[model samples]
Target: MNSSYEQELCNKKLETILVIDDSPTNLEILHDVLGSAGYEVLVEMDGASGIEQVEGNPPDLILLDVMMPKIDGFETCRRLQANPSTKHIPIIFITALTEAEEKVKGLALGAVDYITKPFEQEEVLARISLHLKLRKLNLELDKQKQELEIRVAERTSELSQTLNELKQTQLQLVQTEKISSLGQLVAGVAHEVNNPIGFISTNLHYANQYIEDLLILVRLFQKNCSNPGSEVEEQIEAMDLKHIDKDLPKLMSSMKLGTDTIKGIMQSLRNFSRSDGENKKLVDIHEGIEATLMILQHRLKAYPKRPAIQVVKDYSVLPKVQCYPGQLNQVFMNLLANAIDVLEESMIENQYLNRKESTFINPKIRIATTINKYQVIVKIADNGKGMSESVINEIFQPFFTTKPEGKGTGLGLSISYQIITENHGGNLQCISSPGEGTEFLIQIPF
Candidate 1:
């Protein structure tokens, strides 16, 4: 039986216990009992030294004597309990006092167990073993809690990183979709322009040939008429030389003007269709607005049944801005398109309806660009049905749109905001009131 018990003790895990007492005999006895029970023991002959030892290298449990010199066990326990570092260490009071009041007082002072001096050896072992086991369980619980907290923190960090990545990806997708839509719109416009340009080009060539032939005939007549015979001069006068001179010049001028207009339209289309990825360059802000306007020209110059919106260009002779021209062009397109939509809505709702004459309200879009010391500001304003304060506030928020169903994707302003702020380090703002129209101000640093 003794050998079996010895084997069991050897199998037990090692636990450290501190014994504090003024009497060397009591300290030695406590150390031997705990040590034989498979606990590693430390003995202190003074309460002050014992407190220092426990603080420096905390043990699993402490057996403290109630009466000691300089400092008593009660005082030591109080001090230990007060210190956060050593407070959780299980403490037992070993005193000569067998009174219930003394045990109660020790317990009140944060002692986990109380043992009377002149105690039976069996009772001493039982209490010491129980308290040591409790200390072991507490240490294990604390270790598991610490590990759990670390895991939770790690998971939270990973989740935050994933969320940020997802947001970035969503923003990128939205921008890509916007660009694709713009490309498709450009292609459609190019197709529509081809028919008018083809015919105008053909007509101009024929008209130029006709003018050349007519000029040759006139020169021949002038040369011959300088020294003309009477018969030839009489024939030219009868054929109305004055009428030909007057009518021919007017026809040439009209043809030339028509050709020039077609050429201008084609040039605008080419500028709008130019592929977009280039580094920063000195760009004329007006050119960006013009390109955007060309792309929206079809929309603006629609049937007369639709309101004829007047585009007022208030461009200043500003210095060229150092920026990505294509991105700025996109910003212009979004702003101008929004302005047109607003103006169209206003025309539909004729607020100035009580006039004597049935005069159509001329909606107006105004674009202005200015240069400051270190930044360029582009403002696009529209005299149309404006927005409420609440609507204006959320205009830049992602997926927010004022248009009716199936009319808008709601990513235009939001993506424009991100491109200006995140990519170009610029600012986009709006000023609006209900019937007073709206203005968008975009500022880019040089």
Candidate 2:
């Protein structure tokens, strides 16, 4: 009983083969042979019922008889081979026709091999076993191919992501070094100027007070000593005391104003050069922009060849933003300096070409700011020779520049883009066309 149960379990694990033949004798012979070889077997008569059975339950191999009542084995094979679903099933023709033409025809219709009628049982079992083994090997190869393709796709994606991350890291390091060096230099200059300006401002205040007290004493002397000697009157006339009193106050006030302007400029330089490290601070956005503009004041002034580039500021009331003030200032510096550069280039080009009919006659930069529900938007626009579409597309990429050699490092805009987008969680976009001017919009969330 145990032996019989083991045999049954082994038979259940074997491959299934379907036999289609009109003759009961051939069907019985194939069924017994394949069954004895430990292969599960199913029998059907005629080609139509065989196709129906194959569709319902596909077998690993098919044994088809050539001569049948309705459709012949050739037609059945053709139909099976045409279907993608059951096309892979190996079909072997069982026919008595010995004509070489007939055999070739069967093979052409997608038959793998043929068995002559009254065939040896051993030959039938051998062919079925061989085809079943080939089918199993083919299925495994297909599965392995699919698995390999999936792994290759995953690895390629991982490499692409890693490359992008490496580029971002490199960009951050370069920008940090550039900003640090520039900040140190500017901060040093501001520090050196601070003491002298402060001293002058303090002395100006006291000088103004002393001049007022002396003027009052002179007025009292003039009122009380009505009969003064001629010598005193002559000395006052020669010295021009009245003129001194009138002009001295004005001169002192002008000197005080000049010192105050210097102090304000120094303070702006210091603010622009500040480094915020890695922390965010609540700061006035406008103040940072003002500081950047002050630093670039020399570039904005009129030169021998070009007129002063007009900067129109249309500012809106903005709430203090929590941000890296120094980094944000850097972005402003790059954008404003770029605007100035483009305007100067346009002016120089026009002057060189002697083109009085140029559209950029008066180079101007307009800076506007606004706030929305989710973010702050700052727009800087310039009426210079605008960039072409192709140039605009590649402008944000590292080391892309339109300036001549030795004029630009080609990293200003690229670093600014990273600082705004990656560091601040913001966006920087450029809009421009030929002869129209360029505008860059910077948006940062509150």
Please tell me which predicted candidate would have the highest lDDT against the true structure: 2
The whole-model lDDT of each prediction reads: 0.82, 0.89
The TM-scores of all predictions, comma-separated, are: 0.55, 0.69
Model 2 / residue 352 / CA error / Å: 12
**Regions more than 4 Å wrong, model 1:** 1-168, 177-210, 215-249, 301-306, 351-360
Error of 1 at 172 (Å): 2.9
Worst 10 residues of 2 by lDDT: 352-361
Residue range with the least summed lDDT across 10 consecutive positions in model 1: 351-360
After best superposition, candidate 2 residue 256: deviation in angstroms? 6.7
Candidate 2's C-alpha runs over 4 A off are 1-12, 20-25, 43-56, 64-87, 91-120, 195-263, 297-310, 336-364, 381-418, 425-439
